[model samples]
Target: MMLCNESRKEAAGLTPFLTPRKTIRLATWNIRTMYEAGRTAQVAKEMKHYNTCLLGLSETRWLQTGQLRLTTGETLFTKKSKIKLNIIQCYAPTNDTDDEKKDAFYQQLPAVLDKAGKKYMAILMGDFNAKIGADNTGYNEVMGTQGLGYINENGERFADLCSLNQLVIGGSIFPHKRIHKATWRSPDHVTENQIDHICISKKFRRAWKDVKVMRGTDISSDHHLLMTAVRLHLKKFKNTTNMRTRYNVSVLKTKEVRTAFHLSLSNRFQPLQDQIENNDTNIETQWKLEARKEKKVVLNTSRTRAAKAKAQEDYTATDKEVKKNIRKDKRDHINNLAKQAEEAAGQGNLR
Candidate 1:
């Protein structure tokens, strides 16, 4: 059977472990197969109706593993977060499958879990084709008494894997009706079982609020949707460091740019030389005051048609002159850098 997991978060209170609390609604469903046309749309529509944020789908009958972005703007891919939650969705080998294949599947699962590391709250879920049953005797910490049906060989293996990884089976932890506990049913419409499961790290078990099967949801699949409600906030981290500036220096190879830069530099810095020698501060202040006065006159101009027209004409001319000077200044600045780089390259010291 195929499995698909979806997650949606609602803001809440503070948790003992993380920052402010958030209620994350996570679900896993065996979609069986998405090989038919419009099947993907049906799943996406159902996901939106349920208000899911992150949804992991399995047995899609697509090629190799990769991301699939739907037209509805929702993305299907493996979830990875630096803050806390790390989810791994799987469609394990069936109970009747070869023992070697099952062994290999279980062995590879641990490696995947290990890669998530201890810092993250890892969630391992999907259809394991395992029946954990209602027994919670020796495995009290790993599960609860609310599990459905009787444990099978696959269930024993699944339980052991959860135990080894210190994962708590979400389905068994919460009390619910028998109808709400079963995730899969037989094609003959007689037998029902709870094979699909959702598990979370034991360390964050408190974060898990509830888990149950949603039997009303229909997608032409034998497996029902199993959902887990977890309470833990995802804290956002931001980079505060300033970025360095970069410049292009290859234009220095042009002789026209070098000549323009030389002329601009001489015209601009020659005034600075006179200002420094004469210690002229009042002249600069006078120039600023006169410019402000011109703007004030424009603002206070009479509202007559002729006066307005004249004022607009003057403003436009001044604006054009200012823009022209700005362009010249920018071009000169670029040319100046190019000239400097050319000189440096000639000296064999381009740095």
Candidate 2:
């Protein structure tokens, strides 16, 4: 019920949590196949803890399963937004051929790009099951000019896509030279290939800061997790850029951004006519003072309930069959911290 109510608010684009990033924080993770068990729950837990703005997951296996809804709903600020999850998971044709299967994958690339680009900047992140322009995949300087080669990227497919879409490739090439490089398969597993990948569009290239592949984590799966962070270069209008300018004590008297608070409060309370209304203030005043404290408690309760629920539910699960969701009890703890941080920083722009 709470999720539904909150979702309604979100659908209205009334997300009160998105603090216009002083900078953008984006991350991509190839959370092992969610359906396999606890993996989904663990990934959710991590994401909520980070409160990440932009998140991408790959090898999601979302095409066959409906697990994508859970991911898109909770991550996106609004409920109405389409599930913009960017992960490609499929069975590659195993003629022991990368080119044929890759061609099919590439054929679908345009549609994938179109679908994701409709919203905020899109990232074509997932397992391509293909290698890039490396390891002399048939000598060719023209391919490099055409953006189709890497030192160890055996084939031209990886290069072609990166060049075509201007997507920044996020991953490492060290394993490509070795006999085996695989995210979905390990020595313990049957297959081996570095198929998993994460890529971002040109628009989001500014946020392309850091990309790290988490090689060892007890994820119950043999595949290494890809943890990539992209810092979006958020631009803010400088009120004053001069550092030598004299500090004004009067500036503290100035107001900060007041869009949400003003609209919600004044729109509701301003029409309350007489300062001392018809009901008589003597009785109402006493109760108002008494209730103020309680009202605060309720608001605090709600905030804590929301944030803690997010954190606990995100990380508690140890099985893939069932999501170890955050507990409702811990929400207050998180909300209190958020409130404390807001007060300490004096940045109360919550909307």
Candidate 3:
């Protein structure tokens, strides 16, 4: 959505709200498993319906964790920033899972949390499969008594992890109807629990406005979509060189426009030409002066035309090169993932 000068002018009629850099609508959804036919498309279509800017996914069941580029010119899991806002998506094993496997999952969380930019925002969210009960206890700063089920072993560990990492459990902090708070429902329609969660860095606690489980979307999954409204003002540095003022020279190509331009120039120069003829009466000198004036006009017009052409050419070339490099990066990223998957499979470790 970053536009050059040419495209900006062409799209000047667009509303200001259409600007790409603005408040983001972020959501986290454990889509169960996007292995079903047309599942990715279904998720993408729902994302569009919600006008989501960033969406964290879990249990994607992708062969290997890697970046992907959508056909709509957006990249997933490939953003880089100096002081970026990070979102760590996860899918924890259930309470019945082996202790060793669960320990391994928590063991890896520190690395992910630490990988985020220290000075920026970080959101830890996903289907943790840990039920945090309706008791805040000593963790008043990180959670609330609004949680659903009773605290289990996994919930204690999850709360401890949040306490250690200075993260606030977003879901527990907001008071909602029990139905709205519950993230997952059993197939029997009798058991409802808040296993899925969205957490934000405690440092940015004020930025997180609300968190709720949405049930309107029928994504064919027991888990509901958890959305959080986090106020973030994205700072954009304008490239001054790309902010040049340009005129619509193509308008001059029209017959009526050309006639108008010529008539205006004629009216201006005719008076000067008459004055020169009356005062100097030197034909050659008057001709030279008029030629100089006309030459100045042509040079000014030509320079503008040339500048416009050069800008467009540069934009086109840069765009082409960018697309080409992006395709290469996608290929390389996927290849690396494939290689990692093969290595993991060879070692009998495919998690």
Task: Give the candidate number with the greatest TM-score.
Answer: 1
Worst ten-residue run, lDDT, model 1?
8-17
Clashing pairs in 1: 5-56, 13-21
* Per-residue C-alpha lDDT of model 2 across residues 96-195, encoded as one tens digit per residue: 5676665786678666666655345556554455545334333232122212223333234655656666665654422332322335565567655555
Candidate rank order under lDDT: 1, 3, 2
Question: lDDT tens string, model 3, 225-341?
Answer: 888876754466887678678999899989999999998888667746865665522344455445555544555555577776765565555555555655665676567668967
Q: How far is candidate 1 from the true structure (C-alpha RMSD, Å)?
A: 19.1
In angstroms, give how far residue 251 of model 2 lies from its true place: 42
Instruction: TM-score each candidate.
Output: 0.59, 0.44, 0.58
TM-score of 3: 0.58
Q: Superposing all C-alpha atoms, what RMSD in Å does each candidate have to the true structure? A: 19.1, 29.2, 30.9
**Which predicted model would earn the best lDDT?**
1
Residue-wise C-alpha lDDT for candidate 1, range 41-110, written one tens digit per residue: 8877777766554455556666654455666655555333322346788899999999999999999999
Off by over 4 Å in 2: 1-32, 37-39, 46-81, 84-101, 118-120, 133-155, 172-185, 188-194, 234-351
Which stretches in model 3 have alpha-carbon errors above 4 Å? Answer: 1-23, 72-75, 78-85, 233-351
